[model samples]
Target: MAPIQFQVGEKYFTANTKTLTEGSAWFKSLFSGSDKLVLKEDGTIFIDRDGDLFAIVLRYLRSQKVPVFYNKIYGHNHLLYDQLLTEARFYQISYLVYYLENRFYAGYVASVKVEILGLDHGVDVPLPDRDDDTDVQYYPQWCRKEVYVCPRRVAVHRGNPGGCGRECRAAQGDRPLEYEDEWVLKTTEIRTQTILKHNMDSVKP
Candidate 1:
């Protein structure tokens, strides 16, 4: 059988009608009848959509697998996944849309709390010269004011919950210089409390 030729934007693509129809309901409906299609003079169907994204969509139709967005050299390209989601929605590919949404966008809200605890001494106070206290000095006691507490909201992706702690620490900023001293007895605690906002599985296609 002759392959179906498509012109998406400035690019051209060809695929077997069986693959397109099986992968997408939109394509199945589009080619439902023998006389339904209105091909251009060049014998190719024209689709007013992104050509580059259509290539990815076509690849998925052939392979029936999600495209790899991450590599050792460039890491994960989240923007590419987002673009694929858009293209999948446009093509009415339910499985691709479901996979993309659950793998990346589906996540819970987390409340991150970072606390710094230790004793911190303030500047020494000098006592006034008196008959019996001329050489005396006064030092204020360590107080709770020295403790640091930072609260933040981090979106925890279902694929990488461990990354939430790293994001929380970064958002809390650097620790105090005094805490860096070996002699200073300080403790840093990072806590993450997860809150489920909604279930992505229950979302309708």
Candidate 2:
């Protein structure tokens, strides 16, 4: 059978009827038997949609596979994926729509790094332990109190000398504190991270 010719936007595309019908319910109804499809004067059916994205849809229909839309330097081509998603929904391609939506949620964090700036030892405070049922308690004599330098706040952690039985409690301040010799200093860093699930591989086609 002759391929169906389509003129979408300012581009042209050609696909066999079998591939189109199998990929989209919209296409299946459009090409259903005995119904004559109107065509432009040049014999190509004109579609009021993006031609470039339609080409990607056609390729997926033919191969049942999609290329990885990622770049090392510029990161994932989110714009392209968004465009393809719109095209797939317009075409009523259920599988393609599912695939693209899953890909959107399949982001993974490639790497992470942390840096330590400075350290200071603060004045030791001695307290008697008559522990109430609180989540944290510090033993007497050997307990060390440390203040953390944060971006906009300070956090104080009270722990035993051996770094055990430590509880981190946030201490809000007007501004970031500088490293001081009298204060046992640690840096508190807050970072936003994206965690990838182990089942991410299931989304692969």
Candidate 3:
């Protein structure tokens, strides 16, 4: 896959940087079952004392096994904040864009309280492929709430403009915006320098 090259203006950090192995290992154990990696008062990171910001980006660019799952009750802001580096590392995106997309998709990102470091951090991206619903079954239970159902026959809204007009009329004629090209992946490179600066500062202090 040549590691999916991102657009030039798109943000990306090198992944071959160094890490404080002992610190990272200790950090991982300290926050078991959670992905919140942070720095201690003395500036030692939980994951790596000398972790490379670029390398973390590469980890995400290479794998999808990591997902920042948080307690829905306690809220997921801290979880998301902590994993900003991780997400930027693996997904080849800026932390800002990553958080913004997740926020819009989840529909409640505004309430979460954490600072997304850059000025242009969370701009909205327009919904893409607004007219497709062929993958409705792939959606979560919350997404099925307003779906239109047809009882007389077995017709599902395929979201194609002319794909199922007659079939829907014969079975279930009603329609709702059932689905679109859900943006599970996107690029975010603008905040790379800022993050890199954070890494440098951590090392100095």
Candidate 4:
């Protein structure tokens, strides 16, 4: 058939049925069974999306590789990144989700650190070394003790990306990600207090 026209914002991009169906199941359903698509007199479908960002998505669709613009976007444009994510989900493109998550994780890990509670001390899980270490976040002396990390097991069980919440498994020791640290300690402390309170009541009587 003819090239399917998409009007993103004030601009337009063209795609064919084959390319749309190959990348997105949502598109597959939309094109195959929907009469709701508003087609121009020239038979082009008008899609309401940000043309600039949708252009990036289309590039990824055409070429399996993410555009080099991703490098410029990393660590700089959280807003655009989030917008792109919204667009990706709207289109039901799994590859876009995977690419964004993985790419974002690189910047995320550099700026965030995960800490595990130890019996006598806190074990700091260092992030991957980067050439430019300026943006890597370090814990303040006071906040160091307050920062507790979620283990991979718990995050994965909760459907966090990479089976570890925040893609933090690289820092954990060889243990299941669910192994609780600070939160578990707090719960245990509360439970112990309750038991102690009961014992004290019995003794007082």
Error of model 4, residue 15, in angstroms: 2.0
**lDDT of the candidates, in the order given:** 0.60, 0.59, 0.34, 0.54
RMSD of each: 22.4, 17.1, 21.0, 24.3
| Candidate 3 TM-score over all chains jointly | 0.20
- Evaluate candidate 4 by giving its C-alpha RMSD to the native, one decimal: 24.3
Q: What TM value does model 4 have?
A: 0.45
Greater-lDDT candidate between 2 and 3: 2
Indicate which candidate wins on TM-score.
2
lDDT of 2 by residue, 1-205 (tens): 8887788889988888899998888788878752535578987787778888888888888876654564433556888888898998988888778878887444453433233223223534333232221122222233245433443322432232222221212233343433332323443322222222323332344
TM-score of each: 0.47, 0.49, 0.20, 0.45
Instruction: Pull out the clashing pairs in model 2.
Output: 122-182, 122-183, 122-184
lDDT of 4 by residue, 71-153 (tens): 32143465676788788788888877766655532332323323333232244444534433222333223212232335533
- lDDT winner between 1 and 4, please give it: 1
Instruction: Write candidate 1's Cα lDDT for 1-205 as tens digits.
Output: 6887789888999899999989798788888874546678888788888999899899879877566564323445789889888988878898888878886433332222233333234333333334311122233342232322332443343223344466556765675312111223223222222233333332334
lDDT of predicted model 1:
0.60
What is the Cα-based lDDT of residue 68 in candidate 1?
54
Q: Tally clashes: model 1.
A: 0
Relative to the true structure, candidate 2 has a C-alpha RMSD (angstroms) of 17.1
Per model, state how many residue pairs clash.
0, 3, 12, 2
Decide which is better by TM-score, 1 or 4.
Answer: 1
